[model samples]
Structures are given as C-alpha cells and as structure tokens.
Target: MILLKCFMVIFVGQFLDVTSVYNPMLTYNIRFNKLRFLPNVTGNYTIFQQKDKQYVSGYIQRPTTDEVNKYQLPVFHRCNPEGLNCEYFQSWTLTDLCTLLKDKNQIWSKWYGAFDPPILCPINQYTYVFRNSTGEVNIFLKWYPDVLNYQWKITQKLYSGDFYIGSYYNPMLTYVVRIVKITSYPNITWNYSVDTYKGKYYVNGNTSITTDKLIDKVVGVFERCAPEGINCEYFQSWTLTDICPKLLDKNQIWSSWYGRSFDPPVVCPINKIHYQIRNGTFDLDPIIKIYTDATNYYWKLTQKMYAGNTLVGSYKIETVFLGLSRIDDEGGVVSTDPSGLAYSPERSRL
Candidate 1:
C-alpha cells in the first residue's frame, strides 16, 4: 500500500504544478480583534522532498492540545526515529517542494529572503526569525510528526540578536543551547549556558525561566501590539486570540454602519437556531467567518438570503456556495443533508 501510494503521488507530481496550485504547505492567518484589521500570517514548510530531480513540499501546523489526539491519523512523537511520522506527506513528492515561490516583491529589502525555508527534517521543531539584508523581521514556527509526549518534547525559539530560547524537556541537560540569527549575518549562531531557573521558558540562552513567566512576557507583547478595545490574550507565539467583548457586550455602545436597520434572520437546520445580521454587504463578512470553520462544519443560503432581500444573521443553513458536497472523498465532515443544502451547525454557544 505504501509503495503503491508513493507511485500514485509521484505520478500525480509529474502532471501537477504544485506551486501553480498556489497552495502553501501550511498556511495560518492570525488576527487581533482589537486592531480592527485583517489577519496577517505566512506559511511554513515542514517536509521538503526531492522528486524528478526537483523539490516537492510538506508542512505541518502547530496544533492545539485538542488537535494532537482526536484524529485517527498516524501520530509522530519523539519516540519516532526521525522525530515526526507524518502520514499526509504521502501525497507529496520531493520535486513538489523546491519550486521557488513567485511572490518575491517585499516592501523593503530587509524583508527579502526565502519566503519558506528549505526544510530538512529529523528534528522535533523548526523556527525562523528572518531579518533580511535590510533588517525587516518575520517569525515562523513548524512542528511535525506530532509530538506524542508534549512533556519530553523540546523545541527552540530564536529572536533578534544572538538570542536563543530552548523548549527543552530535560532539565538535567544543564547545558541549554540557544540559536540566534544575527541581524548582521543571515547565518544562525549558537550559545550554550547553565540553567538559572526563572520563568516557564527562558530568554535566548537564559537558563532560568519558567513557562509562566514566558507566557507573561508574551501577553505583554500582545497587549502592546493589539488595537484598543479588542481583548487581546495570548494564544501562542506569533499569534493572539482577540475577543470582541463589545460586539456581544451589554454595557458598551453598539455602533454598526446600519445599526438601526432591520436584521435579516436565517434558520439553521442542525441546531434549529436563527442567525441574524444587518442586511447586504455587512452580512457577507460574518458569513465568510462562519463558513471558514473547517473543523466545526456549517453553511449559509447565500442565494436565498440575497433573493429574499432579508437581513440575515450569520446562521448556518442549507447553502451550496460554501463548498459542501454530497460525496466528500476526505470523509469526517458532519454534513447529513441529502440535498447538500443543509450544513451541520457549529456547537451552539447558547
């Protein structure tokens, strides 16, 4: 089965321009509600392969705790000889990875460099803090072959200057190594030091830090960067979760472009709940947000909502526009509507 699958992947590799597909191996969009701005995030590479004498691609997302164990997919752990045992990689060949990215136009030269790093595996974690010849900064992290035991799994975090922070699980190692990307030089430089034992995680080469203190610093950074009124909270490195408390807050004044206008409501079949929002263009924003919930499936009737000229809330309904299909090759979708019009509602918050 493995060999046959490999042949299929390699065969498909020949005909398909993976780069032309414009699919980043792993893409993440980060947003801060407080900022009143769109999300800004980049892709990361995890598995780089060579096929047909060309590079192919593979990548993984840094999943939350729940994502680590729920799926039946093959899991990777530190116990795995090469670090991560990724099964999805079966679809990609090496030639698919090395194709150069087309978008090289950076706003500044300091930001110019490889958009995605050349991935060479066998490690638990991979990170990049790129400072181009001009000194623009972009940070990225990738973890593959899921770490089975989050406890003993060690990762590294690099920052500006010669700073390296190790997510080391073994306290006894005593010698902690930090890799720093020198702004003056693109190459990584390393330093080793003893443990001072302070925060949940230590500063680059700072031995004495605990995770709690590390989290505190991250929260501080987020608060400073996030826009006002949006509640910013630490979610992970390079990302924060912002709660629009005011959007649902009772005490705050509500200000929508059309707050006084009537809201159209749509009925969701799965939960038997009605979704309501302002009419027209304002309706589009919330619908896209709900449709993009790839995990918790849902849908909306874009056609009916538009035809009825009703102000519909962001309710999940039977909609064909949101890519719900009757025969999904990649099973596990919660859709049950035979007509493919109905969508499974997200877990009801109410």
Candidate 2:
C-alpha cells in the first residue's frame, strides 16, 4: 500500500508540473463611454474569480489618454508590411489557462476558420477595439439593465522548444473592469398648420375693398417633452398679423399649413379685400398673447401673445399695388393700411 501511494503521488506531481507554467505581469486600463461628450463620466473595474463564479467590481472615472496609459502594458509589434492590420492574442499562463478552461461558459473563446482548426488565440463577446490619436486600444463592454460595463486584460506569451513539443508560455498581466450609467438625449419633432381668410369692406363711402392678399406670418407657441413623460421644456412667443378681413366674403384657408418649427408661416388671402388690407402698408403689426400649462406629454395652444407677453417681433407687409381699381365717392384715390391704423384718400399717394 505504501509503494502504491508513493507511485500515485509521483504521477500527480509530474502532471501538475507539466500543466502549470509561469504567468507574466501585465497592465490594463479600462473605461466606459470614452467617446461620449458628456461630463462626469469616470469609472474603473476589477475582476475576481472564485471557483465557477466571477465577481466584477469598479468605480467610474473620466481619465485622459495619458492617465490611462499609466496602466498600459508594453506590446511588441510584429507587423507584416504587406498586411495593413495587426492581430492580437491573449497571453495566458498554464495555471490561468487551466482555471479558465475549467469554466465551460468562459467569456473568452477561440476563433475558427472554414478549413482550419480552432486557433489558440482568445476573443471575448464583449471585447472591442477602438483607435484614438495615439493608436488602438482593446475594450470589453457589456450592457446591463440600466448601465454599461467595461473590461479588458493584458498578457504576454513566451515561446520555447520545437514546434511539436514546444509550448507558448504566458505570464499574467493586468485586468481592468468598470461600470457606468449613460444618460441619453430625448428625440423630438415639431409640426404646425395655418388657415387663411378673405373678406370685403367699404373703405370710404362707396369705395369697395377686396381682400385677396398674402401675408408672411407666424402665429404659434413652442412645446417640448421627454420620452418617459417627465422633465419637459416649454415656451411660447408672440403672434403678429397685418390686418383682419371683414366677416362677410370670408373663406378659411385651412389644411394648407405645413412646415418645420423654424419655418415662417405662409399667410395667403382668400379675396382681394383681404389681400389689399394686408398689402397696403403698415407701421407695427398687432401682437397676440400666448399661454401654456404643464402636462404629461401634450401641449395646448392657449391664448395669443398680447401686451406684457413674450414679444418676439411684429409682421409687416410692404406696399404692393397690382394695378387694381380703387373707386372713392369723394372722387379721390383711396388707400388703407392693413393694420386698420390709417387711411389716405390722395390720388398721388394711391
């Protein structure tokens, strides 16, 4: 029994010696959302393996390239002049390889080709590569329920012996991991519609006026909201118009307004009276008041902009005489400003 026990111990010792190799020391620098423009994005990561389970831990940090390079491991480049790409492989010690292979669901796996056997190189599902001003850096990232986690490991391999019996020896390097929560911007869209009107009115005793004009006007309020129906920014501006058409001989120019929020509203008159009123001339267009209230996700167009409200500007129309007839009972040329502010009965002025 003692001799048998001795033989078993010797066999086990030989097996362990052949399986275990020295692992090198490497450095790893990891970060999350490094390409984002937001502020206060600083995080770090640490990984620990206990039997079949892996534990990851870290804090956030916004480190610069120089700062991250402090933890970077040195790499020996063996570039092929003909090939424009560089390939990287993880160097693992015999002990680390045995430990990693023990986990059937290891995060890293080997690559396989169509006619070739699986290569000894390692790759992870969450691993990625990005290039900055300096060079390329390997990144391992994964999206959790509400946050993003990042990680990467660096190692070096040393080859010894013949191609058949010789083995690639790897030394342990640096491993980094980090978690961060990313804040996203909201998606927004704005729409609007306009309605036109026309009418006729008496200018000065038997001098009939027709409204068929076009006035460039913008009359509306601004609204904004978030995706989850929270945290919204809303505001409204003044609505200015040249003049109003008479009640009779009026037609609604609806279903014709279509434009983005930044575009000005197009006001087309329905009749000559409406057109003449707005086209004649005006000093200051009348301003309308606007009001808005906070709600879930809807914005209601309340009142128009009036005095004491946010006054953006006034709408004005230049004098445009289309050779239309103007008859006055007073035998004098008749002209009226669209703002209804002034009227002149002078032949020369008309």
Candidate 3:
C-alpha cells in the first residue's frame, strides 16, 4: 500500500496563503441510495506510489452501508504497499473514515473493489457535502454510518483530475447546529372542562398526566412585577356566583317548610339544627305524621326531621296538623287535612 502525499491549503481573505504543492487534481464521487457502491473484493490488490519519492493523492470511493447492501458489494482495503497482505478496512464506518481524510490529509486507495455498506441503511450514494471558508459544497463522495456515533466515513471521487484512488481513516461528519441538547422538559399547557348542576359547580383538574406549580414559579420569576405594598393577586376569584344562588334557594325554600303545629302557631328560629327520624312510629297510618314541639319539633309529614340531633319521641306525628289545635286535643287530625304539606331538605329543619 503506497500512502499518497497531499498538501493542506488554508485560504485567508479571498487569497491563498501558500501556493499548491499539487494541482487541484483531486476528484471523488460516491454512489448512494443503493445496496452497494462498488464490486466485492475476493483477493488482495497492490497500491504503490509512482516512485519511492514521487507521490499521487486522490479521494477513495467510499460507499454507504445501505448502498453496499443494495449493490451486494464486498469490502476491500488498501493494505501496506511493502507487504500487501494484512487487511485494514474492516473496522471503520464511512463517516469516520471521511473525517480522518480531511483532518490529516491521508489517503487510502482501493485497488480492485470498494468498501461494503452495513445493514442499517441499505442504500447507495455518490455525493457528500464539504465545508471551506465559503461554506459547505457538495462533491462526488461515498460514506457509511458509524454505528457508535451515528456518523459517516466519506471518500471523495476524482471527478475532474488524475484518478489517483486511495482511502484513509477519519472521524465521522458532524455539525454544531445539527446536534441538539435538550436540557429540560418541553413547555406545554392544557385546557379543562367545567360544568354546573343546580347550585353546585364542578371543574376537572389536571387528570390527563402531569401537573406543575408553574404559578408559584411565575411569582418567583417576576417578583418585581407585583406592587410593593399589595399582595399578589394570583389566587383570588373575581366572581361570587358559585354559592349565591344555592344559598338563596336554601334560605327561602328550606328554612320554614317543615314543622309540627301549635294552637297559637309557634314560631321557630331560622337556624335550629335538624335530625333525621329513622324509626319513629305514628298513631294514624299514612298521615305523614312527624313529631314537633319544644320537646319534639319537626315537620308533620316528613319521616326525617332535625330535633337538635336527637329524635323527639318514639311516636311519629300525624301528617295533618289540626287547623288551630293539637292532635291529642283535637281527637287526632285526618289525613285529608288541607295542611298536610311536603317540604324540601332546607326547610324541614326545626
């Protein structure tokens, strides 16, 4: 294997810093989007310089793994020219090989065949992009992906100059921008549904997946945004609508609807506590009787009523209250009494 001598050039301010030791006699092309870019190699081939001192430099035709698979190509290597026996091309990816060529200006030539493409991406290509001071430009090239770094080894094809073919080991292709660094979770927000039934309002909290105390973080981020003397207004509501209607309905309808009767029409306080009567019995069946009075105040018809958390008596009151008298005093009221009325949860409390 004869190593080609290539000179490095650096351009500054649209001017060459040094004259070319060799002419722009370099061209390289690669086959891409196919199984393999070159023919399979069965035996070793010789690669040597024109003389012991005289040199030739050109890009090797490296192929992508996908291209090798598509073309059914075999792998080949540019062995040492002196021995031409040991194989040295089996370990490198197309991308890694390309980096070594450009950085160190070393070249490896393929004698009879080209490198095989790996199985990950079964395609063939013949072009790759290169960057000089002016920027990236496409040249005829071949490359393979590096399994370790997801990069490619590349070889340039001689499109215009003396076809001096060789290959070299290089780092894979890379970009500062193409590489993304995700430091934190993504920013996302959600919308929820709201519903109201009767006087109760309901809202669906964050039921989907995640919840964050972003509001607390916001206060910290914008500590100066709040006024010096006033508290932060983030937690207060502007409307009292949720509870007002329900409160009014309970007050007007539930406060006075249930009660036992007295001859003088005994008045009860609006806030007396009520209890549920579970097993109270009545003298008259189906009279909607309930026990009420100072000792047993409850609605006449309600099976359950509040008696300071204790039921009044073992007996249930008749549903009907005599027009202006007690049941024991009026010989018990009949179920047909016009005053047997039903009340709501709020009103029946005594």
The top-ranked prediction according to TM-score is 1
Clashes of 3: 75
State how far residue 213 of model 3 sits from its true place (Å).
Answer: 19
Candidate 2: stretches off by over 4 Å:
1-216, 228-233, 236-267, 270-350
Candidates' C-alpha lDDT: 0.20, 0.21, 0.21
Worst 10 residues of 1 by lDDT: 1-10
* Per-prediction TM-score to the true structure, in the order listed: 0.18, 0.16, 0.14
Summing lDDT over every window of 10 consecutive residues in candidate 2, give the lowest-scoring window: 1-10
> What local lDDT score does residue 44 receive in model 3, on the 0 to 100 scale?
23
Task: Tell me each candidate's RMSD, in Å, in order.
Answer: 25.0, 30.5, 37.8
TM-score of 1: 0.18
What is the per-residue lDDT of model 1 for residues 113-133, given as tens digits with 9 covering 90 to 100?
431342222222333332111
Q: Output the TM-score of candidate 2.
A: 0.16
Give me the overall lDDT of model 3. 0.21
Q: What is candidate 1's CA lDDT for residue 326?
A: 30
What is the lDDT, from 0 to 100, of the residue 188 in candidate 1?
Answer: 15
On a 0 to 1 TM-score scale, where does candidate 3 land against the true structure?
0.14
Candidate 3: tens digits of C-alpha lDDT, residues 290-323: 1011011112211221234332222111121122
Residue 63 in model 2: lDDT: 24
